[model samples]
Target: MPHPPPLGDSAGQPGRSNRVLGRRGCHLPILPQQDGPAAPLPASPGDAKLQRAKEALRLAGHPGDPQSLEAVGLMLDKLAKENQDIRLMQAELRVILILPFLSLAPQAQKEELETLLRKSEENARLTEALQRETASLQAAQTELRLLREKLQGLGEAGLQRHRRVCPAGGAGTGPQGQVPAHYEGLAAALSTFFGSNGTFAHDRLSFVDFLDEVEDALEELAELLGVSKEDVDNFEEMALTQLEAAPWGR
Candidate 1:
């Protein structure tokens, strides 16, 4: 994309120095007040001669061919609507500016004021609906946020439950029923050999039965002494080969 010419580069440009920024503001014509139902007066967006002068240098851009007519029609409709809006405003303002001078009874004026207020409220129906929709969306978002938090809490609780369920079995309580650190550590290490995820490659069934015996012997050893099984890098050290020669039994 090409960059716009710099302000300094346009120093010698004829129109650049003369160009005025912002609007000159609108002028409301002073006309004799005519009493009647409010109706917009004939209005134009700008001077036709000025518009034509500007258009001479650069004619209006348009959609090419077939769709151009439809586009033009839509644009004309928008312009017409905007022009009608000006007339409506003029009529309303004329009525409002003359209201104070109208020689009407206070009761009549009060009734008219009430009527206008009622009309204004009626026109605000769409705004009311928008407000209701916004409130409902906020309620739904709040409910969604609460459900997400609840789901997160449930996930954390499930994780805690999973942690409590020992893969190698027996979870004890406090004091005398507390699990020995060595027993916990050894059981955690041996867990893979007891389940479907076990890495045991041979005599798995016999190995599982042997593990049950080991558990019993290990429990007794924990009750008698503070020590537990160690040096378990090889299967031989844990008596994995012998049917009954277990480390805990020793």
Candidate 2:
């Protein structure tokens, strides 16, 4: 058997360079750049070797079968495929504490991978739920702001009506000082109905400052009359005044 080629004949290049395999000096065999890195083939340990392979039938060579070259190429292709699968798998996975996965049992590895998957799914669900809750809170805040603005508007409107209805004076007056005929008649009739009590006297000129002043005055008058609770019209004047002057809660 022939010995392996010399490390160098006269050059500084790392591996043998010769015309037999082109100036791509260190590479085993020149093929295409697509397979992977063009590397030197591994040496066979002993009896198994390289130089003694069968050559392609049409070419001039030796002791192996016709399928040898094609078989070696297919093996390299399988190796390249395995390298690609490793790259793809690593993209989605990460090892904790930089530990090598191969050191753990196969079942332990499976459990670790499943735990990662379930945690990732739960994190996604929680993120989506938090976003929805945040949106609902923002909507409720907007509605509350609008309601507060509406309530403020109503309060301002009521205040404006009060100022218009009750101006800065002890009495109320509508337009000119003279009363209309029917309105004067109504006042005179009310005066005749109440008759000379003087407190309830309604005339062409008299007016109340507060809206509830007349009703309050009437209640005072009824209390002074010693009127029965159910029949206000029937009363003893002396008994009513004495009761009104008595200390309350006695």
Candidate 3:
């Protein structure tokens, strides 16, 4: 009834107050601690550092671990198989592409190609030989033409001289006429020269052989005529020219 003598008045009241405080004290809630048999977290900071050190050591020219070696071998084997497959595909493609050409090329075509090559080589050789022969023939022809022209010129000059020295007179002219005597003698000698005993005595002498004999005889006649060699040469050339101009000779 006195209000309990004022609550905080005595020293012995401290124990009673402590007990009240304990009853109303604040405390932290206790979490359940994860223990063994539970799934662990990822490696901690210190464990990660140790793992990195081990990786660095392994990378510094160290032998790979068994797992890494096995994985690498498997990768290399896969690459090798892939390479082989690619090579096989390439070979197959080549075969497919080339087979048609090979089949389409006839045996005869191959032979003809070889033959053409041989013929081309032969033709080259023959062409060189022909060129040499043609050049030689050309030179010979040039020399022959020059000789013919020289002979022709000399014959013309001789004929002119003979006409001056031995002028033929009229029909009644005597044997003393220089032209008449020379022609008569030449005709007689030619007839005798062409007789059976002559060099051109064959029944059917070639025109060339006949002419050669005639030219020889004319040479002798020119010497006997006491005329220049040019005169004889000119007379022979005139006879040959007349023969060549004859229709029968042509």
C-alpha lDDT of all candidate models, in order: 0.55, 0.49, 0.63
TM-score of 3: 0.30
Residue pairs with clashing backbones, model 3: none
Evaluated with TM-score, which candidate comes out highest? Answer: 2
The residue-by-residue lDDT of candidate 3 on 1-250, one tens digit each, is 4543322424745332312222355333445656779787877767864665555545544465666555556656765997999999999999999888976899998789789999999999999999999999999999999999987886677667566656767563433443434556555656643444433354766757767777787788776545576656656655544334223534
Number of clashing pairs per prediction, in order: 2, 1, 0
Best by lDDT: 3
Candidate 2 per-residue lDDT over residues 1-250, each given as its tens digit: 8874655534655654433434554435434346777677877653242333232333333336546556666656765997899987786466543466555659877789889999999999999999999999999999999999987886666555434433434243333321222233334544542335434334543444321443354345444433233322222222223223212412
Q: Where is the poorest 10-residue window by lDDT in model 3? A: 14-23
Q: Estimate each model's TM-score.
A: 0.25, 0.31, 0.30
* Model 1, residue pairs in steric clash: 40-87, 192-198
* Residue 155 accuracy (lDDT) in model 3: 69
lDDT of 1 by residue, 11-117 (tens): 65544232323345333333555799779676575666346445432333543554555555655676699799999999999999888766565888888988999
